[model samples]
Target: MSEPLKSEIAREAEALGFDVVRFTSADAADGAGAALHAFLAEGRHGDMGWLAATADRREAPLALWPEARSVILLGLNYGPDGDPLSILGERSRGAISVYAQRADYHDVFKAKLKTLARLVQTLAEAEVKVFVDTAPVMEKPLAAKAGVGWQGKHTNLVSRDFGSWLFIGSIFTTAELPADAPEEDHCGGCSRCLDICPTRAFTAPYRIDARRCISYLTIEHKGHIAPEFREAMGNRIFGCDDCLAVCPWNKFAHAARKTTLSVREETNNPPLAELLSLDDAAFRARFRGTPVKRTGRDRFMRNVLIAAGNSGDVTLMPQIEGLLDDASPLVRAMAVWALSRLAPQRLRALRPFLAPAEADPAVRGEWLEAAA
Candidate 1:
């Protein structure tokens, strides 16, 4: 496609609600692949074996799709209306990550990406593939190369105009477009993001140990969370945004403009008591269109139990008691921990009766640990 056509495509992207648009060659992501390989080699990704499984494809856009010559990166801003850190102190309520308070970004951005891709295909008569987060595309590096933003010390893409709140999407096209100048790193000497991690998930300036990340613990992890990180997790039931929220660049971010991306009132600071009460069906119904639903009720409740333990709200003791007999050992184990924190006497009183009946070794271990 011609340079003028690329400009027209950028205009169309903005019309489709994308905040930023840029282009880069498929080969631009080769350097980032080295970082991915290194991260995998150090076993920093934790249980997210998918990252290691798709390492080759994710290393470069060309490996994912050889037919593609150009990568069109698009960013949609989901900036919060108020200080995200404010909710962290509200221990009785769950502090969901801001981006997850709205409808799932995959659903919100997928249609828009396809629409833009179709337009590109029609105008340039080029083959196209669209991807949101599900695909194994290294979007942040490609986005940085495309001039959308620079990869900050937190390893997330940070833009001068959009700050750290952009949701990235990629469009791979057979037609080559002139690449935009890559954005220069603007995070010089700023360690705000690295220093703000509750779990010290950032091992260094740009490296993250996902095993300790609350977002990964609450959402991606399938089993019981390790004891060390549970208390540090606090009331963050869905995902953690400490690093992103602390970024100095967010001062320039505007509140989300798209209605679909706007935060749902019910999701903002939801009561931990209410969330802890959600059964499988209720959990699904409550978070239907939001990203929290993807974690499923078992894992979500496990997170809720951790928040409840840290909440210091003895009022949630009844809810914690109720979860002790839950079908999922993950939930039951965390519930035992929550009870021990909120009502140790009650936990001690019930240990004899509970421990004998619990068949699961993990749950029994939780009760045993709490009693000791």
Candidate 2:
């Protein structure tokens, strides 16, 4: 593709609501493989075994698609209009990550990516493949290589123009477009992202242990949350944004211009009591178009129960009480934990009746541990 065509593509992407666009060679992502291997070797990825399963393919764009000669990295800003941490103080309400407060970004970005890909194909007569977060592509490193942003200390791509709030997408094509100069790391002396982690998920600057990440635990892990991190999880029901919210770079960020990525009022700070009452159908209806739906009713309720336990609001006892008999053992177990924290006396009183009826060993243990 000609340099003029690349400029036109950038103009077209900007018109499509993408905040940043740049190009890099497929080999620009070659250095990311070693770090990924090291992360998996130490099991830092935790229960996200797919990261291990797809490590080889994720290491290089060429491995993903040999036909790809150039990688076009696109970024869409989803900056929050207000302080994301303010919701954390509202302990009775759950704090969803700002990015998840809207429609699923994959759906939104994929459509835009497809449109841009079609434009590129017609202009360059090149074969194109587009990817959002779903694909096993190292978008952050590729974006950094493409001059979109540097990978911040939090390991998220942080742009000088968009701060820490950019959602990345990529288009790999057989066209050999001119690659942009790589962006330099600007996170020289800041450690706010590292220190602000609720679960201390970051082991060091730019390195995170996913097992301890609240986002990973709440959204990706399928089973019961570990007791050690429950108190630290706070009221974050969907995903944690402590590290991202604390970044000073966000000051330069503008509120998301895309209506599809804007925060929904219903999801902003939903009351814990209301979330606890959601059944499968109601949960689906409430989070139908959002990323939270991927967690399913059981896992989401389990997270809500954890928040309820941390709330210390004895008034939520009735809601917690009802979940004790929930069909999901994960919910029942967390309900016991929440009940124990909020109403230990009631838990003590109901133990004999509840204990004998509980068949799940984990649920029985929660009752025993709470009573003890």
Candidate 3:
């Protein structure tokens, strides 16, 4: 009875454009709770307090929704057409993570998941709910357990077929569906992913500290960026893809279909000078419908200013200089650092005029630190 239901769900998932689909019981992902506790205990999750707040729900599907009997995990291929790391050499241009270059994956995958969930409900007469990244879903471990892919050393889901580029989502249903065997980890002794990190976010093979991760710093971090990470950040304005890009498994991956995620040409490696000019409205208008916009103008500009600081292009000096008076202290702090990097003499020349008037202590600290 459930075999037919699982088959129908699989067919519907494919029809809805999900590249891969698998099923698993909604039981606790074995030992995932312990790992979650350990990660939080060690403060590896950084500023993402939601992870700690929803530990029970994140530990298992049933914990999230007790009615959930089986989970339908899906992976959508979002592999980029070229090398994601090549942008690092273009210091004048900002590097956005390949997954973020287009439409928000959360929106794209959630729409397809809802479409697929309806089929599960109709076929088995069961209650169902769909989830993308927004929830506290342990998608990586759950996907790995469902044979969607294995969590590689970098602590991300890795697929032999789709490589590291799969955008994973899941559907939980009350119906009991057939479950797939868990995928085996094939990253034996392959240290490429861990070795390639710019900030060495990985403390060990599978353990990561988000505090040091550029992706976390540029996107999730809400305060003044730590001074130590600034120079290593390069032009990664939104998120870092270094670990994902270096995965050897990505060679077999295929680019995501345009219908699933259309690449926004304007955001693809936009000039640091141009990005520094965005005010609140322009930033929202430019990154609308994309994950980048969710970071908001202040944080996004902070990342851009870091990129400008690393750009070494004197032409960006004026744009960087203007941000010294930005409304957001986060923006102004980085602007001071950027000025110090791009044009120290100019920063020194303007210091007597600007330093005394600075109100925010963090911004004042940046001025003192840079002037030192």
Prediction-by-prediction clash tally:
0, 0, 0
Ranking by lDDT: 1, 2, 3
- Span of 10 residues, lowest total lDDT, candidate 2: 26-35
Write down the RMSD of all candidates, one decimal each. Answer: 0.9, 0.9, 0.9
TM-score for all predictions?
0.98, 0.98, 0.98
Where in model 1 is the C-alpha error above 4 Å? Answer: none
lDDT score, residue 126, model 3?
93
Candidate 2's C-alpha lDDT? 0.91
**Residue pairs in clash, model 2:** none
lDDT of 1 at 286: 93
In model 1, the number of clashes is 0
- In Å, residue 135's CA in model 2 sits off its true spot by 0.6
lDDT tens digits, residues 1-372, model 3? 368778888888888788899999999778888999999999999999999999878888888999888988998888888888999999999999888888898988888888888878888899999899889889999999999889999999999999999888989899989899999999998999899898889999999999999999999999989999999999999999888888888888888775658678877989887888899989999999898999999999999999999989999998888889888999999999999998988999999999899999999999998889
Would you list the C-alpha lDDT of every candidate in the order shown?
Answer: 0.92, 0.91, 0.90
Q: Kindly list the per-residue Cα lDDT of model 2 for residues 88-196, writing each as its tens digit.
A: 9889999999889998999999999999999999988999999998799989999999999898988988888878898999999999899999999998899999998
